[model samples]
Target: MADQGVRTDRLGLLLEQFDQAREMAQVRLTGLGDEEYLWEPVADCWSLRRRGEAVTPRAYGPGEWVLDKGAPDIPASEYAEVARQAAGGMPVSKIAEDWSVSVERVGEVLAFTGTPEPDRTPVTTIAWRLAHLHSCFAGQWEWTFGERRRDPRLLVDFTPRAGLALEAFWATIDRWREDVASVTDEQLDTVGFSQYPYGSDPDDPFIAVVAGSGLEFIHHMAEIALLRDLWRARFPGRG
Candidate 1:
């Protein structure tokens, strides 16, 4: 009975964390406009783009819009090495020979894959960040409650407009909350309760996944809020 009480308390705390994060996110997102949503504070920032405008090797979602996301299996380390070599004025052919990949492949990596270097990481637009946050919640929910599917490409809703995107994100959050609300204490204690493939969810206790999800939400929402403040600072009197 005590164990059951502890589990219930833990679940309740996780749910409350989600509720607080969602409320704060909604407040931060209030009155956001397309211009602010898509604003590029720095050049060549990752953002939501029209279907044909994406420069990434792989983009996601259906409809006329896409997020500038990379393939899940992208060799980020190899791309980072290629980027480092290229930055140091090494010829692509030399880098390719050292890495045993084609010169064209090296060029493709440089063009399509992002560098892991702190200075080279592209600033992401609000739209990109929000889309990422939405995808995280939606993907976990699908794998945890709806289906065991691991493919995020199947989950659409990369809306281009800010208002529509927020609506879609809110809907996802609502669905996730509803699903998680029904999770039993036994489920919380069960390892592999969440089969979310993108992360270590399959090996983690459902309670841990819930806690991690809350942390993810809080950090990303704080980032979005900071970006909003920066935007306001950059362009006085403009949202």
Candidate 2:
């Protein structure tokens, strides 16, 4: 259990992280209207095109700033690697703080990416990133705490307009945050506490799950941000 040997009051740190990630994302997304959300800096860019658009191009990400399966392949995080290499690994509270930084950086890059990659998996638009957040969180929440686990791809409507997508994204994060805040020590120690199917949740400790989630959120959000940079650079001052 995450409660083992640790002080009682701080056991809820992961809950804090969930809140931080959502708030950071919300603040960053506030200023953009539909034009910026859908803008693609280049021809054949892999941004969030309206759904049912022909995939004959298949160059975009299942939503991209590049046309490859993994363009700009997320560079490894030296800080996280070093932290993990440290003796027993980072403390829970520190990991939470790290994720907060990661979330903030995601916003910073969103305001900064100023290049284009028409030849790669294309770029991910703000809409795509928000939808990704919504679908991923909603699926995890359903699997861990709701009835009937289902594939997010099959269940989520990624085609929603940007405004609706943002609304759903925030609401989904709120649901996940509530669930995280309610976790008990037993749940933290229990194997498979989350029951999320994609990863090791079926066997990993709940504390481990908490840690994994931080990395996952940070990495994906960072990728979205870099794509934002790429989009901006491609389009000039519109960035």
Candidate 3:
């Protein structure tokens, strides 16, 4: 009942934005310094902590879990504190560098056309990001197809081909664009399944998930780009 031509038009604009953000992220990361990959644009951001750094337990609500904690119903101060605590002082540069290292591994595995290796530690490495992309894609697909009973699952490949970091990130963006492209007005308003189970309401509807995911992608890309910029500034000749 919420479907309308106006809604479709708005979604089209948002989809274009998603593509641009993805592209910009790749552009920013290219030719960045190896050390720059560990730059933190601000304090309390997530980064690769050295060995012995304290690790806090991630908090999640009871019941289902989503990819990210949804908008906090609590006051802004508490929300910011939680996010700050979650970041734990890791730099954006570290995240990019870690991701780049994983890309190198992906390139080798794919180049040799070798068999996929088992995930010894699934969530700890860049493998998590790759698997996250796949899961997000699968979840979006299930939601679009109206299959609410299925749950999104993540699988990791140890040996990845080169350029995979960009490929995986960009591929998800492309899929989202495609999904939104064919989305009818009626479907836009339909409730969809999200990996973020504890954060979302079952009756909330699909449009929210699609838009929220797009926004999440954009935010991540922006962070990546900022890291790249910081790296370039820190080491002027590297790029």
Candidate maximizing TM-score: 1
lDDT of each: 0.80, 0.56, 0.46
Stretches of candidate 2 exceeding 4 Å from the true structure? 1-10, 42-122, 223-239
Better of 2 and 3 by lDDT: 2
Output the lDDT of residue 136, model 3: 60
Instruction: List TM-score per model, in order.
Output: 0.75, 0.60, 0.51
User: Regarding TM-score, does 2 or 3 come out ahead?
Assistant: 2
Tens digit of per-residue lDDT, candidate 1, span 52-107: 89978677776678888653332565566567768878787766665555877777
Tens digits of per-residue lDDT for model 3, 1-239: 23653334666766766667766766665654434433445444333333233132331212232122122222322333333422665343332232333434333332443343443321222222333454665555554544554544431121133255346555655765776677776766765333343234233466676677777676655545555555557667774
User: What ranges in model 1 sit over 4 Å off?
Assistant: 1-8, 71-120
lDDT of 2 at 119: 34
Candidate 3 global TM-score:
0.51
User: What is the lDDT for 131 in model 1?
Assistant: 92
Least well predicted 10-residue stretch by lDDT in candidate 1: 113-122
